[model samples]
Target: MKILDKYLLKTFLITFTTVFVILFFIFILQTVWLFISELAGKDLDLILVIKFLLFSMPRIIPLVLPLSVLLASIMTFGNLAENYEFAAMKSSGISLQRAMRILIIFICVLSLVAFWFANSVIPYAEYKFINFRKNIAQAKPAMAIAEGQFSDVGFYNIKVNKKSGENGNILTGVTIHEKPNNYGENKTVIKAKDGKLISSEKSSILKLELNNGYYYQDVTPKKYEDRSKLPFVKSAFKKHVINIDLSELNKVDTDQESVASTNGMLNVSELRYTLDSLNKNIDNEILSFSENINQRVGITRTMRAVKPEQKKKPLPNNLLSLFKKNKEKLELIKTASSNITSTIYSIDTTQKDLKEKQRDINKHYLALYEKFVIAFACFLMFFIGAPLGAIIRKGGLGLPIVFAVLIFITFHFINTFGKRLSQEGGMTPFMGAWMSSFILSPLAILLTYRATNDNGLINFDAITTPIYNLFQKISKRFLPSQNPQ
Candidate 1:
């Protein structure tokens, strides 16, 4: 039994390592592709790019590990079953459950490690990745400008129709919209045939030198009758220089505390604290809103003062007198109605804001639950893959990869769909987080039972036989007289 355990552990580890590396590489490549636009044309050093990729790896691990476990378990168990090793173990009176005991322990440990990685390591990585990207953006101010798009640099919005030159410093068909200061009546617009950017590490300003440009500035007329004239100034300049302040971009802050409150940057404890704080804030907001509404509407539980046994007044005989008596009451009713309408509108706005805040809270809860749920997925995948492999008896990557991908896709889809539902308030955070595992666990158990009993995993005959018969009947009914012959 000890020999068997050692052999099984050895085989599982080898497969797990191989699958993990392959999946990690594939996912990292995918990550690179996803962010290529951000990293490309930035003239970043090789080291910075590598650092970006490295920082991204921790986030990928949580996604990759479970799929690797699934693939490894399937391939390992399928090879054993295909080679008749399971039969030999059974002949020696070893039950399937007993055979899996050691491997199960190993998987549980892996799950715990996964949890620790998600809770501790990934948060730090997330913080680093975010700040690293920010640093990259700030490293080269020119990188922020893409060809044929509006780029915001300080107070100006610039658009370039074409870019050329070795360093991409030369811009053609340049358009710059300069925002106005407090005293300026309208924005200053500049269009140039060509422009060149000049900046240096020592300087705290970016200078754009424009050639053959036209500047237009609108002027507001002081008199109403003169407004139709729409006074403005348009001037053509042989050369013009625009200065942009870059002092803020030169500094990169590495303090993690700056982003500590973000959902992805916090550990479980921090997440819980943030969630509690948000809920308390929401409660206070609701209480304050209610109080405001009560004050505005003059709501009170106290009874109105009773008149001291006053005699009933006789009705007014004249129409003018009656009209005068009711006019004051009608105006009071109109004023009360308007106040009620305004209060209702205010309440509606408050409810919308409260709902948005609640959704944000749900998002935090989902993130909190995801840390644990993703870790537990490793164990669940192993259970599912091992039994499935044993039942299929197909070794190697051919069939196992297909099954692993299909199962993983199904799991991922359910998880993503549930998360979206939670975000939209269609589902509770807990239910959304665990929905995939809840669905797959029962299938894992069923597969295990069928595999252990040596019964067909899918009962293909039961499903296919009826379909075949139905096809045959359809064919006979559709055939011509030649079918009788």
Candidate 2:
């Protein structure tokens, strides 16, 4: 490599690394804050928390890497332009395009690396992260119960007005409603002033100790003779103990392969296969429904036993005979009307289902295209940031950071809006996925062109010059006496 290429690459790499680390940590902290309530007061081990954060890194890296590239490119090129290194290079016969050659190649390679991570590492991490969260949720059954909300715990639904104590196990003003079993016809209700949950790691039972409670049992009569009177039982107790089975809650699936399929957890090949299968199913359903509707309407079946040409001669010549004939046909018309209504309703329902399935297919397609689109965005962002830095001729965290954030926000907003539109069938999946790229790529090219020619970041004079001259002319005509001096 030439000395200039080496120097540019070195500076760009240093900035990229620093920016990547800072953005990654920022995103991770944001993720932690989002899940703080679920993680806190769960008596979870520190190692488990660390593992959760580690599993989350793969998902966060994809979002961070592009922004890092943008900021680093802007800051690196900005510094070069600010310090006159770019001018020196230009004077030495190295054009802006020539200077960017090595870095562009580097960014292309980085884009491929980003794609590899999205295609491989991200899917695995997404699957593991989802299952790990489920495991954590199952491990802390008591934590799932929040204050002032009813939560199902085994056969009972329990609600608490207040939860205060270590590990949030102590409950106040508890209300428990026991669901009826197969043989029972009535529900049992229990209200307690306070309660405490006690469980051990190795035990399969969670025991609830209640104080100052009343239990009410409803008894319904079995025989008709006793139906006139309703019976119930009420009992008051200072303390009550309820044991809940925790065997199911403690069971975590060890096989990661058994995790349910999600769009975010599938690679391109899997998504394609799913999309194809869904489309085939939808087509077959539509065909079958059409045939069913045809048969229901008797379009393909003969309603009369005799052939149309072999039927007897018509006999409805008088009013009485015509009335009798019409009466017999009325039943047939009613049956046909009912069948048509039902068929229309069935077709409407099936069409709705087909639409939902199509939306799911669109989601899969969007996800597949998103991986490649975001990878390409890294390259696009560099083109934008590098030239923008040269044009602005400023360096450091202040201006560059602000510009990068604004550009990225616009890109992200367009991408999100397009995805929503595609998911709702308002736009094609490919177009929706590539909308941001299409919008930004031209801006990048324009900035690169302007920067290469030594033009200002924006040509404000071209627009403002005409307006200012027009204002001066209007002022002179309106105030001629004052302008004479």
Candidate 3:
């Protein structure tokens, strides 16, 4: 290797490593803050907490690695420019691109490693993290229910005023709200003065025993007037036991909604397989629904067997006239109206269901595209940072840090916004995942082209030099200059 190449590599490596560690630590703190509810006051073991954080730490690499590369590149090149090292290299017939050759190769290699980590390592960590939380919640159901606030655990939102036990199994002033079910309302509520959570190591159920509690369930009436009275079924019990399935202990602990979306748990090939199956299932469902609807409104055997009258007559102006009695005509109209309404309702409901399935499919596509995005982000950030550093011509922690933060925040914000919009069916997953990259590519190209040509970020000297001359002329015109009086 040439001396210049080795020097450049060493500088960049040292900067990248330092920036990566600092940024990783900052992001890890943010992660801990996000999941503090699950970790704090849960009576969890120290090793368990450490394992939880370790599993979650890998997910931060995609964010941290890219930002670190960006900051490092900017700082390294900016520092060289600021210190006139680039000036020395340029005089030695070394162009900016020549100096960056080794770093470019290094970045390409890093991108590949990033892609592998996102595909293999991150997914495994997500799976482990999710399941680990689930196991913890199951073993200690109290973790799922925090004191003072209602914590969502499967079908119930449970709140406890106080918990006093080694494992926080003994509760006081318990309140439970059953989520909406067949009743279509969260009307079932249970309150107890004292409660105890009982669970066995071998069992997959948490038995909550409530003492001196009242169970109240709303009973909706068919008549609107009767509903206004708000009738309810209330019963007082000396001791009541509610069995909760451990499997449904709110599988989400870290993310917005991980359990409902298993895309995080699957690798590339697995996601593709799942997507294919989901597509097929949706197709079959639509075809089945269409056939069923056809049958519902299809012409029956009786209609096919009907014979035409011997003498053809003009149809009546009013179809109701064909019926002998007015009452019979009214009955016919009512039946037809009800049937039409029901058919319309069925179609509407099916359309909504199909839309939901499509959104899920989009989420899977987004996840698949995300692995590629993180890999490409390395390349993207490097290009932007390297050229920007050369162009800015200022270095160190202050200016480089400011620039890195603004650029990264823009990239991250756009990426996050696009993902959310894509998940909501605002755009295709492909466009959503690559939107930020596309938006930033132009800046990188512009910077790189200008930097290669030895152009400044802006023609600042042209602007400033003219202003300086104008001010000098104005000063001479306004006041007499006395050299030696």
C-alpha lDDT of all candidate models, in order: 0.85, 0.86, 0.87
lDDT of 3: 0.87
lDDT of 2 at 164: 83
Tens digits of per-residue lDDT for model 3, 91-134 = 98989999899999999999999999999999988988887876
The candidate scoring highest on TM-score is 3
TM-scores, in order shown?
0.75, 0.76, 0.77
Residue 24 of model 3, lDDT score:
93
The best candidate by lDDT is 3
lDDT of 1 by residue, 305-363 (tens): 33435436654675345445677768766776667766766777789989999998999
By summed lDDT, the worst window of 10 consecutive residues in model 2 runs over 221-230
Clashing pairs in 3: none
Superior candidate under TM-score, 2 versus 3 = 3
lDDT for 459 (candidate 1): 84
